[model samples]
Target: MRPKIENITDLRGEISRLRVQRLEQEVELTKVTARLKARLHFPVLVYTKISDFFIELFGDDPEDLNKKKENKDWVTNILRVGLPLALNRFLFPRSGFLMKSVVAMVSQKAAKNVNKDSITGIIDKVTDWIKSSKEKSRKEPRMADYGIPPDSETY
Candidate 1:
């Protein structure tokens, strides 16, 4: 007989693993945040207007940028966790890929939980992650040295 993939215990196990793993990724997240905070210069400690980053990074359309700016919370929350998770995925391809998968599963359920209070919580979490990550890296590095800037041939 074939094994079933729908075990409740397995799902819970995966979620617990993801939460712990996400916490661990907090270290690299700090590095990325320090780079961004230094380069972008957003007035708020947290990078609240994340669409600007996307536009600067990708050369997105002006109308799309404005729309994204209007729906800023959605952008902030998505980028808050998604950016570091993405960078980690790029740097260490074998890591916590399953957490991204799990987030996909729970995200719809999580949408209802996205209230004003929850947005505040997301902002706090992202800001804290950046601050903690920056503290860990004693000295800050330049973005140009990393080749992630305006006139770079590589992305």
Candidate 2:
């Protein structure tokens, strides 16, 4: 390894250099340890792992999500992601964290039932109802003078 120590002065120099090298290595070790400690910090790490577990548990497969994107099955994804969020924000706005979490879990499960076809059917029905309402509100033909008296701006 190191060249053979010759004189006393050289030995002293080598010892000083070795000590400096050891201190440098120790400093590097502390830096690495700090980085590891930050990464392993309890609350953040646990929260991340728990959230990941819940996501996987709740039928969120990475490949499936990608496939859904390719298929443009946005309705299912939106329902899954948004329904729980909407419920938590609106239905349980003032509820405690536990109740909100329960609502979110339940709504996430229920959202599975609302696929594109179901949402599209509901949308079609709503549009049809709106169209029918508009048709029903159409002005009616009647006796001309009586209708003018009712609709016209006059004394």
Candidate 1 C-alpha error for residue 89, in Å: 26
Steric clash pairs (candidate 2): none
Compared with the true structure, the alpha-carbon lDDT of candidate 1 equals 0.67
Q: Model 2, 1-51: lDDT tens per residue?
A: 986898999999999999999999999999999998898798788988998
What is candidate 2's local distance difference test score?
0.83
What local distance difference test score does each model get? 0.67, 0.83
- Per-candidate TM vs. native? 0.20, 0.43
Tell me the tens digit of each residue's lDDT in model 1 across 48-100. Answer: 56646756788888998577556546645665566555655675466576765
